[model samples]
Target: MPAVKPDLETADAVAKPILIRAGVALIFGLTTVFVQEPSTLWMKVAFALYLVFSGSAMWEYLRREPVPVAMRSPLSMAAAAWMLGTIVLLFLSAPQAIGLTVAAALAVGGVAELVAWFGHRRAFLPARDQLITGLAGLGSGVALALGSHLNPHGQLGIVGGGAIIIGTLLAVSGVGMALDVRKARNLEADRAPGRVD
Candidate 1:
């Protein structure tokens, strides 16, 4: 028997959550880069909220994959742990500590992606997505490390700038996806038996 394909509406509905996440990230990134000198309390609260939101999105993204339980479960757990550690370090107002924590988390996640790509090459779709994401994570880790060491006080701007760029990219991608979904829906409707286009 052939595999049943999902309808256009179903596909669009499934993608809605991811689109929302991308929008949220884009907004947060844009807003974060503008705060010249956030107070310790503000940093703690902001980081806490960011971790919760981003961590949930990451978990959901990974969980939606068709990878093995062992791999996905451990990755989900690592993502959660990374968020918790980063939140704690941010709350302590330790820039270097936070940077190191983020660096380590990114590095670990990146390596795991590479390993997963190699281990389950057939199961993984989107040819180079895993590799690209992994490399980007590693690169961001290095940048964060350098920023923390060179200018702890200026790290906020560095982080903010990075967030802005990332957020903008995500927002654009989300908008593109939304357009694609709309187009698919329209095409489907046009093909309906009684529809007059």
Candidate 2:
């Protein structure tokens, strides 16, 4: 597969959505971290909101960006997972149900990201970032599923920890990608025809 050349528009398109996602994850992580013992209601509210916001961000990415064919399906499935999870969380107050819903969403989304990365590893720079996020998501999902018998607090901790890790990773990757694209554009312009030393 041919690599997509980085440029100003592409940089902005990718960076903006990624940074938005990072911000969302960080915000959710912080909220969960500060809460001493999150109640079932609190978990439902926070998880629902996070899923809605993050899923919308992913939808916006799909709508605005010219995503590669190999990635479009997986990304769509990930977004759908979030949406369905959001709906389930909104209705379910039991800890086990909530845990299971979250686990399914995270696992599905994580697998989607990994599949996208595997299929298009050579096509874009963000594929590396996707790998990290995928692993984090998958790990979090498995942890949550295993701890489904635990109380709300345990589930909150696992999900919150994962959010923070993924948030930091994406934030760093987005900033680095933007800078790299800018540098590439500058170098290309400098080496253009009729350029003077």
lDDT of model 2, residue 174: 77
- What C-alpha lDDT do the candidate models reach, one value each? 0.54, 0.82
Q: Model 2: per-residue lDDT, tens digit, 74-93?
A: 97898899899998887787
Worst 10 residues of 1 by lDDT: 1-10
How well does candidate 2 match the true structure, expressed as C-alpha RMSD? 3.5
For candidate 1, write residues 1-197 as lDDT tens digits: 12322333333443454455465556655556666667645554554554466567667656553435555654565466557755666546565666666556655655665665565556534213445544555565567677666334354454444445545544555455567668866776988899865
**Cα deviation in Å at residue 147, candidate 2?**
0.6
Provide the TM-score for each candidate, comma-separated: 0.69, 0.86
User: What is residue 117's positional error in candidate 1, in angstroms?
Assistant: 5.7
Show pairs that collide, candidate 1. none
Superposed on all Cα atoms, the candidates' RMSDs to the truth, in angstroms, are 4.1, 3.5
Candidate 1 overall lDDT versus native: 0.54
- Model number with the top lDDT: 2
- Predicted structure 2: lDDT: 0.82
